[model samples]
Target: MANVIEEAKSGRASCRTCKKTIAKGELRLGVEQMTQFSDTPSMQWHHLLCAAGKLPGELKGALAGYEGDVPNRADIDKAMTDSIKSGKAKPGAFPYIDKAPTGRAKCMQCDETIEKDSWRVAVERELEVNGFMRKSPGYMHPKCVAPNLENVGGTMEDLVSQVKTNSLIDEADMDAVVEEMTGEGGGDGGE
Candidate 1:
């Protein structure tokens, strides 16, 4: 449960929460946590804003101890505030974009490509074994959400609103992401 801000030694490491490269020599937030794969805790790297979006409740303590430069402190604060106010209790479970940080994921629904910078829905399936809980992540293209989540009480707009409050995506980007997601826009992805 230790955190630090450090320079990325190389481009090989990407943000665990964003899947985007933190340019070499750029300072990044590293949050340590226990994982099933290792006896020792591993450091999880995240862009400042990404950390704010994904783990707002923990950001304060992490930031309090960090001494390195945070180039976008204001933006990070705003994102963290928004996420904290989202009041969903468990932000991680909310379907979000980029969202799971899987570099190249195939949709579980349509088997189509989820390219970088495009909208992809993240859903988690929880398993309880004996006494502990574990989660497995699944991905879907925006168009695939309806079929994949056919019976979910909320609508596409609800998902978008959740993502907006919990992720670093801006309103303008969300509009386009929503458009591409709902098939309201051309299929070219506006590229």
Candidate 2:
């Protein structure tokens, strides 16, 4: 028997939804597969929320056009099991694992303050290959985490834009300023 969980645990695949590299020894949201009666075979791994986002469109007209509420872990697990048994989904087909919270000062995406006691949803900016990927953890304050994330939209270009817009001084201007300071007797006590 093929064990998808074991495969994912060994780092052979990744999440299709988030496009992030899933590694071994990580806790995945779970695997899922769906296929229409006549449609070609398709399967994917999702990052819980990412899977939820796709459900409405993926279910098509079968679903009554209503966005459902948040589902518990058990609900997703059952769905995964059902899909696997039906051969529509295979285990370890889609690899995904929600990264664990790391104690960091501010949200990397928005620079918001974080509380020390609990874990808040945060977007990790500098994700590494493994061994303690650096994260920008923060309080997120419930309301702010989602919208702020939506607005910022975690991209290298967005961060670069933020850095360019929030500059202290231009490089040329800084050079001139430094020259002026250095020319002033070097601030030495010789005189």
Candidate 3:
């Protein structure tokens, strides 16, 4: 089933975005997900505004098909527009490229701190946290991406394709990332 925008049937379902209860009869966005336990996909509910912020593209498509009234259509539309332009990916949607927002993240390949304001490649990695294994975003320098992907089961070509499809960065930034990842255009050849 596709994603949908509809009213909450009950207050029991807490929004996946904010972890708050969606008051009964309030508008919510449901993103369809497939679980291993069930053949039928289930819907993950989020508060309408929260979905607009975090899942802009998905929410925009769902909103297009929704026939009911929306409480703050103007605000939600503006937020979705701004979010799409921000070049940030939805939470847990990896294999993208974005500028490092902070200097604290270290490259998974070279283990060096990624400087803030520089472009970085983000990929999904499995991590064990408090005895539970889950997928999380891992950061790497663009120059380190080829080698990292070699060890992690993807080629530079595959990575470049995924980054191009998944990233929201503008054309110029995307070109630079591709050049660096592919060791072309004086990118030190993944040194």
Give all candidates' CA lDDT scores. 0.68, 0.37, 0.80
lDDT for model 2, please: 0.37
Top-TM-score candidate index = 3
Q: Rank the candidates by TM-score, best first.
A: 3, 1, 2
Looking at model 2, residue 45 earns an lDDT score of 50
Flag regions of model 3 displaced more than 4 Å.
1-41, 44-54, 57-82, 86-92, 128-133, 186-191
Write model 3 residue lDDT over 84-148, tens digit each, in one string. Answer: 88766453245778888999999999999999999998888888999999877799999898777
In candidate 1, position 162 carries an lDDT of 55
Q: Candidate 1, 95: how far from true, in Å?
A: 28
How accurate locally is residue 174 in candidate 2, as Cα lDDT from 0 to 100?
30
Measured by C-alpha RMSD in angstroms, how accurate is candidate 3?
A: 8.0
Candidate 1 residue pairs in clash (backbone atoms < 3 Å): none
In angstroms, the error of model 3 at 23 is: 22
lDDT of 1 by residue, 119-190 (tens): 676766565768778766677877777776653337766776655544445566666666756667654432
Give one clash count per candidate, in the order shown: 0, 3, 0
lDDT score at residue 74, model 1, on the 0-100 scale: 90
Report each candidate's C-alpha RMSD, comma-separated, in the order given.
12.1, 20.8, 8.0
| Between candidates 1 and 3, the lDDT winner | 3
